[model samples]
Target: MATEVTTLVEETSAVKPNGGVTLPIYMDNHATTPVDPRVLEEMLPYFTGKFGNAASRNHSFGWAGEEAVETARERIAKLIGATTKEIVFTSGATESDNLAIKGVAEMYREKGNHIITAVTEHKAVLDTCKRLEKYGYRVTYLPVQKDGLVDLDDLKRAIDDKTILVTIMAANNEIGVLQPIAEIGKLCHEKGVIFHTDATQAVGKVPIDVAKQNLDLVSISAHKMYGPKGVGALYVRRKSPRVQLSPIIDGGGHERGMRSGTLNVAAGIPSACRVAR
Candidate 1:
């Protein structure tokens, strides 16, 4: 059977009794977006009939939930040109940013103590890098061009033997300016410095192939692309140069031990994977 789903979003505001427009027309998609009804409907069953602990492997319900999660993982991996084992779910892009930056810093301290990022990056990224400064880690906040793009020449100059990681956002949330991610990725790989991109604003909005872009780590947010809130993912490359990170949250060792906790199966799995592709 073929099933088609549609989303009903109110684009225009209705007039009030006094003829004034509605307070918000929801044009601020850069901040957050409304949940698509189709996605909502798709996820409803998991909260009720399909409700089961994905970690519980002893019953049919658990098996079903776990199967859904694996399918979702496969879908997400396909969207980014990655293997299913590379995707790690997180609460949101903020958590993913923290994990990618802090995790790499902690794990690769022996390799180097320096990290590179741009000034136009999201607060989640900038703040994390700022916090690392207090921990004796040297961070180079590269200056972008007047058009809000990072300079490749400047990036080449910034890298050194002590440089461990380079994190740059794929798109500017405020201006919507796209960066030269492929070039940056190629440079980072050649220099042996791990590259991580905060792709919250760019994942679904633009084309991203982790393998083609030579990206080591990439962050994604479901809400940013009309899937769901409070759910996101982090892509960790596992081949050629295997990227390893210390767990920021420790508990049940979920998400392949990179992020340890009970998976937010309902929203995190299906909703996040439904996006980008």
Candidate 2:
């Protein structure tokens, strides 16, 4: 069965035309995936005829672009069991992870100066936490089991009154090990610490219900899920305990002022549609 599955995946990703290798056979899906044809079709108009800044509120072209962006947001939100208002678009998961980590650290500085995370996290996460350490934040890097799964008891013991966030990845990028996200989320909520997950490798491939899992923040990437590159979103929980963050990129107060810049309407809309579909 494993052999059959591997063959099927290879066939689906590339075709050996004329008994020669495909020019670009991609096996590193953890890094990115080729854009689905359906998503490409959806992205074409935004790049060509419907090109307009989503922030431009006075013109018809802008309105159309804004409408498309909002629809995409709704689609992405529905797919992940989150509200449209909670989704903040960004360039990709690295930015999303940075935003979720640094934003939370800055916003909650007065409340706490400690964060807990597993050692085997994406560089986006580990690097962000490292930067925070330079600024006086204490980070606890929990050790994982032999199978690359974090020990829940270790995580529980690491929590202190000064701990403010628990950041973990939903799936391992290289090894494809699935973490216990729902369990971690529950644990964080019980301790009054915010739970954030870099869901780039897990978003479309696995089931994620932010509400059910009690996730406070989630980072996602479009390219990881058969969508266009350079587009992603961060889901910030709005109720039960509203999650707040400081904007990493300050400009025109876009994305509820969490991320401010001209929206990438062209790639973003198609990315969202791919996730929803």
Candidate 3:
């Protein structure tokens, strides 16, 4: 049976209001974006004949599915200045933030039980720190300056021998303020702590070079960049102090055992589109 679809979004750039402003306008792009037509066009094949489980190893169907994911990954890697192997797909930035924080905390528990982040960080990060506190881990929620940027001096003072990870966001989703990610990454590297940035609002809009910034892990979302929802990726540095994470999920061991789930074949390609092939 063929199901009819509704066209909710206006394809035209914008409709003018009654001499006020654009009508039917989506004001907060920081939160999300309508999927681009190009992305949708690219993803149509996978839902039909190309449909297959990426985890299936013996069939041509599986091969097609895996190729789509890999191609999508290559585009994601290129957008963020990362290697294809460094990208780990996830449900979204929230999960990416959790994986980066909790993964580091659990994997290096013997080394340290302390983590640091800013007061202005995304809830995924700040709340994860709070949860860690309940688990007997120490957390430092650094204060932001009047301009809404993390205080570098405060951050330096907060880093102690036990601090294992530092999670900060590259851009503020609410205020649209840019953080000093480069400086923070350099500082974290000097202090020998892992640096994770929620670049959901920054990746496609700005130039973020993981190596140049000395960043260890970066969280990226597709919906924020005119792609679809329900998918995201994390960049975990592989060398120059390869970052390790303890898997929060356990099953088929997809996503290199970090996040285990049947890869969202259709949603993934478009979700990571523009960021994907």
Q: What is the lDDT of residue 161 in candidate 3?
A: 93
Candidate 3 vs. true structure, TM-score: 0.91
Q: For residues 1-277, could you state the per-residue lDDT of candidate 1 as single tens digits?
A: 1222222223234333454556445699989877777777878888898888878889999987888788878888888899989999899999999999999999999999999999999999999999999999999999989988999999999999999999999988999998999999999999999999999999877889998999999998888888778888999999978999998999888888888776666774455456546
| TM-scores of the models, in the order given | 0.91, 0.91, 0.91
Q: Which ten residues in a row have the lowest lDDT in candidate 2?
A: 268-277
Segments in model 3 whose C-alpha atoms lie over 4 Å from true places: 1-22, 268-277
Model 3, 90-198: lDDT tens per residue?
Answer: 9989999999999999999999998989888889999999999999999998888889998899999999999999998999999978899999999999889999999
**Model 2 over residues 3-100: C-alpha lDDT tens digits?**
99999998877666745878466578787787877788788899889998988899999998899899888888888899899999999999999999
Screening candidate 1 with a backbone cut-off below 3 angstroms (N, C-alpha, C), the clashing residue pairs are none
* Model 2's TM-score against the true structure: 0.91
Q: Best lDDT goes to which candidate? A: 2
Which stretches of model 1 miss by more than 4 angstroms? 1-24, 268-276
Q: Please give the distance, in angstroms, between residue 246's alpha carbon in candidate 3 and its true position after superposition.
A: 0.5
Alpha-carbon local distance difference test for all models = 0.88, 0.90, 0.86
Residue 97 deviation, candidate 3, in Å? 0.7
